[model samples]
Structures are given as structure tokens and as C-alpha cells.
Target: MDTNQIVRAVKTPVTLVLLAVLVYFAANWGLDAVRKPIPPRPPEPCVVQQIGPELTPDHVYVRVYNGSKTNGLAKRLGSVLSADGFKVVKRVNADRDDYPRSLVVGHSEDSPEVALVRKALTNVDFMADGRIDRTVDVIIGSEQPGAAEQPDLKVPLPDGTACLPKIQTVEVNE
Candidate 1:
């Protein structure tokens, strides 16, 4: 073969070999990056949600807090609230532990979600804190209230539009 023919034949193979090596290395690097471990994500606290006229226990989002000296009171009440069909997203100790009576705190005392929770417990009173988010905080005081028997789970909102806490995956940790 002539010199040009030999050079063309050698150049094609060399070019192909270099291209194959480049592609293989790039693929391996990409896969390694993809396989790297991803850190766990923290849970979101709460979000305001708008719902229809009727409010049910399932639609009500709650965070139970222990304001009493009793240990695990928040966790126990959270479970009871969950069993009653309320979406209990969090259970934690309150900032204070000297509450004399359990209180339900919400954006407004007239909120449907607050009213439903208030009806489900005994010896509880409503306290409006004007929180923007519609999450109803149930603070268990030294005199914790017992769940009402056959409490009404569904109630219609007199107002056309109602804002409540967006239901999230349950996080029953203290």
C-alpha cells in the first residue's frame, strides 16, 4: 500500500480508540457521582391549607405539646389524637411545663379545626394566638384532659372558606 493509504488506515483506528476511552471514562465518572450518598432531609413543620366547607378529623392537623411535668405526655396524647383520626404531625415538650389547664392554641378561637379539637377533649379552653399558619397546637397541662366519648369527627364551617394546617406524614417523635 502507498504511504497515504497506510496513514489513513492507522489514523482511523487511533481516533476510534481515543473516542472510546473518553466515553468510557466519562460514563464511569458520572455513575460514581450518582452513587454518592445523599443526606436525609429534615421534616417540614406546618403549612396553611384551604379546604372545603366541611372539616373532618382527618383534615385537621395538630401538634401535641407537653406543658405538664409528666413525662411522655405529649407522645401519649399524640397517639390518642392520631387514633381519633386527627393528623398528629408532631409531639414535643412545650416551652413551659407549668400549665394549670390544657389549652388549644390556634389562629382564631372561631376556626373550625380548633373547634373540632376543642370538642374532642374535656376541660380544655381555646386560646387565639393569631398564628398565620392554621396548625392547632394542643398543649397538655398538669391537668390533662381526657378524650371525649364518641366525639364528633366532622363539622361544617359556617364560613364558605376555611384555612387549616396542611396534613403531612405523621412524625410521632418527641
Candidate 2:
């Protein structure tokens, strides 16, 4: 009926609507601030590594022996092996010349240097001795002529048997 009354009536409804909208947004923002943030994702799993045995040829002392009756064989082999980075400690005649093929005698079969030396040489047999010294005995035979070669400095890799670690199995019930 009156202009002031009409203005006041419209203003009350508009103010209530505006206040309701502001309160709705403020309540939502307050709830978001109180809520916990998402945690960072866990790092990816890593592979487990197993330590393996290693042997160095440069550190291994070698003794060349002439299993063949051919003269100057041991000295020649010693010279060649020395040039190839092998530490030739001595060059001498073997106790006997009965060996038909060359031989690589190592103190232990599990050693890394033994595998490396055995792999490099041709037509050679391996022998394990009880001697505590880490010396490798190379007996040259008459059959393997021109067998002296450059030594490979890299250590030989272990076999699959050496790599397989013991694993336990678990049983789960549903």
C-alpha cells in the first residue's frame, strides 16, 4: 500500500537470500579447510640384490709348468702370460710329462680368477689343490700348440646355481 513499506518488504527477502548464499559458501569453505589433505602416494618397490663372489687375475700369482717335453715351453708361456697381465711367479718343469692336454690348476674351484683363466685357455683341464696359496698352476702340454693368448681381465660370471637364493613359500587360506 505504501512505497516505504513495499521497499522494506522486498529488501528483507533479498537480504535474507544474499545472507543464505554467503553462509552456504562460508560453511563449505570451512568444512574443506578442516578436512585432511590426501597423502602422497608410496614409492615404488625396489629390486633386492645379492652379493656375488669376485676374483681378480692381476692379484692372482701364477706358476707356469711345462707338462710337455718341448724345450723352453714354460719360459715362453710365462713370457706370453706376463705380457698378458698375468703375474707369472715362476716357470719350471712339471713333476712329470704325462699330461696329454694342458691343465689349469687352481687352489679352489669356487674362485673367480680360476673361472676366468679356464675360460681363456683352450683344451685345458682344471684341478683343485689343497694349497692355501692363491697361485694358479698352468701346465702346458705338447698337444695344445700356439695356445698362449691374451688374458681376459674381466671376472667370470657365476653360474645359475650360484644365483638361485633360497626362497620360502607361504600358503594362504580363504
Q: Using lDDT as the measure, which candidate wins?
A: 1
Q: What is the lDDT of residue 28 in candidate 1?
A: 100
Backbone clash numbers for all candidates listed: 0, 0
Candidate 1 to truth, TM: 0.65
Candidate 2 displacement at residue 80 in angstroms: 1.5
Query: What are the Cα lDDT values of the candidates?
Result: 0.84, 0.68
Using all chains and alpha carbons, the TM-scores for the candidates as numbered come to: 0.65, 0.53
C-alpha RMSD between model 1 and the true structure: 10.4
- Model 1 Cα lDDT, one tens digit per residue, 50-168: 56667888878899999999999999999999999998988999999999999999878787878889888888878998766678899999889899998877778766456654444
Model 2 / residue 98 / CA error / Å: 2.3
Flag regions of model 1 displaced more than 4 Å: 1-53, 166-174
For candidate 2, the TM-score is: 0.53
Question: Against the true structure, whose TM-score is highest?
Answer: 1
Error of 2 at 49 (Å): 22
Give the Å error, residue 21, model 2: 99
